[model samples]
Target: MEYFQHEWLERNLNWFEGVSKLIPSTNNALESFNRVIKDENTLRERLPLSRVVVVLINTWSLQYTANAKTVHAVPTLNLGLWTKAYQWATEKKKKIVSHVNSEGYVYFIPAGQSNEVTDLEETLNASFSTFEEFKTVAFSIWTTTIPNDSNKWIEGTCNCPGFFKKLICKHVVGIAIRLKYANPPAEAKSVPIGAKRRRGRPSKARQALLVQ
Candidate 1:
């Protein structure tokens, strides 16, 4: 258990808090692309080492990169983030402690609300489906700053983990909404707040695999 925690659960593998190391906890992107190559180009066949290299070097990589990824004509707000901003703004529950300093308008946002995971026993017992869900219950007080010119709320820096990873957080967005600096799109209101990743592996039939 100690070995696993130090190796896999720590920064070398999983970024639990991930403040400085703003990277994903899982190597899902590389693993997903590996699946694509194995199933599509290799035809799920155990080829000779030389043959595999030839296919990868001659065909797979070139074919995959033939087309560029989709590029939006204009920069757009992430739907999920917009949804969270809307939810935080609409709820109007959490109290924001604000004051003016030499730098900017400093707001101390209490991120933790009364929720589950009261004790270590309860935390251990709970079957959290995903890391995101497990981490949804935050207890930290995020220090957020919006410049004197409220129009620059988007430039706010937040001490929260979300801001560190994505360069934006609910605290900044919530304050921006309150200060009339930004607004969530209309679609945000309809988005389901409690959405979670589908539990368990997808059915084999749904999974893309080449079978001889």
Candidate 2:
């Protein structure tokens, strides 16, 4: 634990908060000084211990002399990046489900029907023999996205942020849901959202944004 703490300190010396016994003992400041001195010449890089010590003192002197000057730190990024990630993942849910196969290849049918269901197969598959099974699988998969110590889904890595900065990771899951419906082996069906399948009205905020 002490060694790990020391390594952490070395890596983040510039960002140090305060002096505490709990903090690791690592002289990264000295090491950085050494690097600066040796940077100019190959022979100096291999300098003897006496020369190295002199070089270090010079580096520290330079740093202290320049201390009064102000330097800008990196600017804070927008908090909207997180919000955008959530929205993107939610919207892309439908696309990810379109690519699973029985072998977990590029294609697989959802559990239902009698036709051959490919990953891109337009039909929904019903793998479970009964509604109870379908419910169990859907609920189980859904819960995986809830955050936990294991990072089941909510906090773990999903390619959403990497693909598009704010994309929600649900595209793959959405595609999977559709694939479940596409399964031709059983009699599964795509149930529409009870409210309505078509867009009926825009939210007030959306209308306002459009007007702007």
Candidate 3:
């Protein structure tokens, strides 16, 4: 146990402790974006650099225009873990209400010491304004570990025993929820309205209509 704590856990898991909530903990979003790019007809096979550039530019331009139209709207959270984490936080809110009221934060009890309840870490706490304060609660739990190089929680160290066994815990969910609300990625650049059209020959359908 000591070896695991000092040699492996301490060395790897703590790297992004503080900043993990500020950015995505997984590369799923980037992977989805790459998938979209590859799905495009222009990118499905090997192509010349010039053709790839044209396709990329056209795709990006269209995306920029679409994003600009909805830039002010609230974005939805679609990550599966985030939804589960928010639900867990909700279920546990009543159990932690008194601590939150007295200490001004939620306490993280170690898995082995779940029943003792008194020796709480002063610095490690979760904060939320209301039962619906999902992001705040999640941030508090996610940033509990000391910052180190691994920047992830692969095992359980909290009162949530599932974590140590390398399962998802509510605390992790909370962090994911917080990240979903707090540090959304930047929107694509907006294209100007009324931009000049790209020059191209009329389409075959249009040519047929003209001939008719």
Candidate 4:
């Protein structure tokens, strides 16, 4: 309780708040793209600025062209980017439903209303911890208003570390699943079939040989 009150609660309490505008809450797409860059020699090794620019331009061009094609083929659910989030939310649904069956009740409150103290046991059982130093702080599932819109409650929030850091948590996922089915995001624009690909960087070995 002390660990939660002092450290975990304070830092992650509002992580899940105000996520209505987001589809998955997590930036997995961006992370995956970064991982691809890291896996390639582009970012792992120190290269000349010119080479770096070439590598980035090439990569971005390929991705942009591929994304354009994908969007054209399928125009729903952010071009299937939300697939993982949907799966995650589905799994959490089972757990939450089971928990509700056993526990009898799980409190659901509006996003900003969590400040009002209440019975802690009534909250969702979404607390988790990787370190022994801190006590696990259970998250309370709450409904959040969509960003730039006050009349809609399409967003959800939780007080979990996952939600705080990556903007994803079981509680938030559960809400997302329902919201996504009810209303999907707008379709992405497709790339032209004959889009031009970026040119590759000059070979350093060839440049060195030419100089010699």
Q: Pick the candidate with the highest TM-score.
A: 1
Model 4 accuracy (lDDT, Cα)? 0.43
Off by over 4 Å in 4: 1-35, 41-44, 66-154, 175-212
Residue 194, candidate 1: Cα error in Å is 11
TM-score winner between 1 and 3, please give it.
1
| Model 1: per-residue Cα lDDT over 1-212, one tens digit each | 45544675674763345444334445775798789778877888888999988888777556648843343332235766777777776665566667799879987666566322234335435555555655553443566787888766777777776776566777777778877888776666655555532444323354568999
lDDT for each residue of candidate 4 in 70-134, tens digit (9 for 90 to 100): 44221133333243344434432222321232322233532322444344354443344443322
- The lDDT of each candidate is 0.64, 0.35, 0.42, 0.43
- Model 4 Cα shift for residue 157 (angstroms): 1.8
Residue 119 displacement in candidate 4 (angstroms): 5.4
Please write out the lDDT profile of model 3 over residues 95-202, one tens digit for every residue: 331233321233443333233333245424544344446433343332223112223322212333334333345565454334342232222011122232234432
Ordered list by TM-score, greatest first: 1, 3, 4, 2
lDDT agreement of model 3 with the native: 0.42
TM-score of 1: 0.47
Against the true structure, candidate 1 has what lDDT? 0.64
> Model 1 segments beyond 4 Å from truth?
1-16, 19-21, 48-50, 57-66, 70-81, 98-107, 114-138, 143-183, 190-212
lDDT: the better of candidates 2 and 3: 3
Whichever of 1 and 2 has more lDDT, that candidate is 1
